[model samples]
Target: MNRHHHKPRLVNLLDDFAFGGVSRGLGIFSSQIVADAADCSVVAVRPDALIAPRLDADIIVVHFPPNWRRIAFLLSLRVRNPQARIMHVEHSYTRAWEALKVEQKGRFRLMLRIALRLVDQVVCVSCGQADWLREVAQLPWHKVDVIYPHAENPGLCTLPLPDFSCERPLVIGAYGRFHEQKGLENLIGAHRAGALPGTELVIGGFGPMEDELRQLAGNSPDIRFAGKIDDVAGFLRGCDLVAVPSRWEAYGQVACEAREAGRPILVAPVDGLPEQVGSAGLVIDFTNPDALARAFATLDNQRLGVMARAARRSAQDCGLDRQREWARLIRRLVPRQARPIGVPVTA
Candidate 1:
């Protein structure tokens, strides 16, 4: 079988699809792209993965365990599928992650550089991260594409602005992996110190830090964990304010989703969170418990409503244009001469 004679395929290779923003982003993008593409597939580079995206039945899934063997498998796939536009979205590394694993910096950089060289392009979710890859990882700027993934729940984007009449208790909601990077401890302490008075804190999602976070919350009846939420819209609608106190974020998808849900967000000023939030939401120093608490305690319903409107507008500004741009870039990677005519769904 001549690979060159076959239809061009867009393949997204991921190491894992653990419950995180990256996986969610990848799944959303994959779902959208498959409609505009001749054929689309996803490969999980980890063996016996707990969960993965429910892609089209016709899409091929190549599963392989992690390490050197996975690299060899990818290399072989590249050789066989010569016309396929293989793009590896780098979801595993960021400046914060590098800082955490400083010991493996040199080896990891070498590995990343080598692995990326095999693919048609490398996609980074944020511009800041794309810059990091070009500067620190020594990848050519041409090969690194910054395609911001839409974080909105498609079902919720059509909903109206949440009612911020201040009728109920000032509900402050935070969701995501309960990890150190999420700054859940600082949030918990702020709540415990009586900084966020007249408010009830709801923490949702699960992670390795679940036990530690529970311990941090202690017997505070004011703080509650909703665990993994399947109904994202219902969760965001219930909150008066959505807080994303990430110590570091490649791109804070939660903030984007909150905005689309018409809920104002309180976010940390780091990486892509600031870029995504823009002037639509409040920027807080998540490390300073006093400042965080004060910001929450003092915010009025009128101001909250204003921020919510701004957030929804911002989300509208950043939405489908990205999907169209991504389709254009993917088309460039696999020339029109190779792939069949498919509708650019964003149009």
Candidate 2:
């Protein structure tokens, strides 16, 4: 078993703030895989991008401007390290295409298509995302693989479920970037409909909609905007239930994370979120605020406990070990010649 032969040089390309669940999950999984079997590095498109501290130090970090120069930088690096395998952890094809259109010149779209073909594999965070890559970006299905990201190591939390002490205030918490796709407006409407006797809504994150959301929550003592907390697990631990009323989702990583943390999740029956939540959480209609309000009203401590237990059990199937296995399967699908040669085998 040649140790040096086992190491595959790998590069991951991320566009911006790696704090989101998808980015964080990919970073954790990639770091662990690289630490155990391969040599890996991460490249942030923006120079001053904020990244998770959990990323392995051995995974070299690089930054480049999100212009034509970024592509040029990647090309130069590829030339210098011809053996390296490049994996684009695509968060959003829409953003990628937008970047290509704005930054590059001279058949930029064509160049992007060609550049995508050059890579051994393009791993999409969800099946919807993979489809988007193929349909919108014109990437071939054979080149795309769906690998739903996993939660960070769940062992960090030690808090036992709080004794069903609160009067079950019909509490609901939504976590994600404050964007149009999140359906925060719908959630607010649902909250206003007198969903429960004592309803409280807590939203966590920061975005352009922050001011609008704040204004909407005005004088509503029942609603609180926590504004981008560092410890999501802590918040999850305290919440009775979680809601993800997304209009569209490539993959709802927060739903998966909440489930892993043993919290019942209520998500819009859209995209890959329902698949991720499985039977553990309620998947309701995204368009109907009244339906969402009714769903929240039905949530109780006993029901939450049952759902949480099921969620935790189901989450085991989507953990880091499952991700590692998927990575191995993807690697096996790659051409043997393209893989690192003479690698030592280990379980």
Candidate 3:
């Protein structure tokens, strides 16, 4: 940076600033994390999909996953920003996802390995994800650092916990895109098996699987769809518990939000979810037909109250120092820029 603009330039390169956790993570990083330490900004690489001649930055944080087609682009990015420290934050692709979705595992791994070589450092969003990268992908552990999806959602954090003393039918809420990856089929199946008696399932959000999910519900009075939710905290507050049955989630933002809202969560032990859930909520193998219902069958007002308090405490624990992590990482990786102390004194 020039003497006039002395702060280090921390720029985020995003494939799409459209939606989803990856985009939201960039928003959080820009507003909360990097703003305090550097001159922060974002470049949406997907909108116009142009590779500029020069991207002026001292530290470039990448927010998108790499692919075979993007390999050339990544090489170009590295070549262009030779002076900057480029860090690729891998926000997608766990081994579980590759197992379920990718047909050619060997080829895919090669692509990832190639892409990773172009960046100076690799950042994973969760510890579990980082572990998988080191173990399965055979990436060097020295180059990997995990930074979980975190933010200050004051609305959810400040919300009053549900009054668990009320003897009412349990309300379990599900939110997010209606995708096969989310595995709502497992949750719907658990409810339909009559395993979840006297329980209500409220789902929100929209996607291609909307019709399939609704059809699976099949006129069940207990299962309802609230459509696309604008007020997430309000939606979370209405429920006694939140369920995330994702088959493969690298890191679950929904689970985090539920905890922040002072509501306990039920998550499948998939990818990084168990790590995020910690002791604050229930971790069941949603793939097991009877597992979810069995957990739900045991919940009483007393246990729910205990879990709610734990959820609040867990949320508090998560919010600690996430804002400062980026600054620390920049300091660790990027060379310090000399700042002007003042005009030199002429003797």
| Highest TM-score scorer | 3
lDDT of 2 by residue, 154-250 (tens): 4423435434456656567787888887888777766766653476888898898888888877778889887786787777776766888887776
lDDT, each prediction: 0.69, 0.62, 0.81
- Report the Cα lDDT for candidate 2: 0.62
Clash numbers, per candidate: 0, 0, 0
Error of 1 at 149 (Å): 2.2
What is the C-alpha local distance difference test score of candidate 3? 0.81
Candidate 3 lDDT over 174-290, as tens digits, reads 999999989898899888887678879999999999999999999999999999977888898789889999999999999999988889889988888998776678898777767
RMSD of 1: 6.0
Candidate 1 vs candidate 3: the lDDT winner is: 3
lDDT, candidate 1, equals 0.69
C-alpha TM-scores of all predictions: 0.80, 0.73, 0.92
Worst 10 residues of 3 by lDDT: 338-347
lDDT of 2 at 276: 70
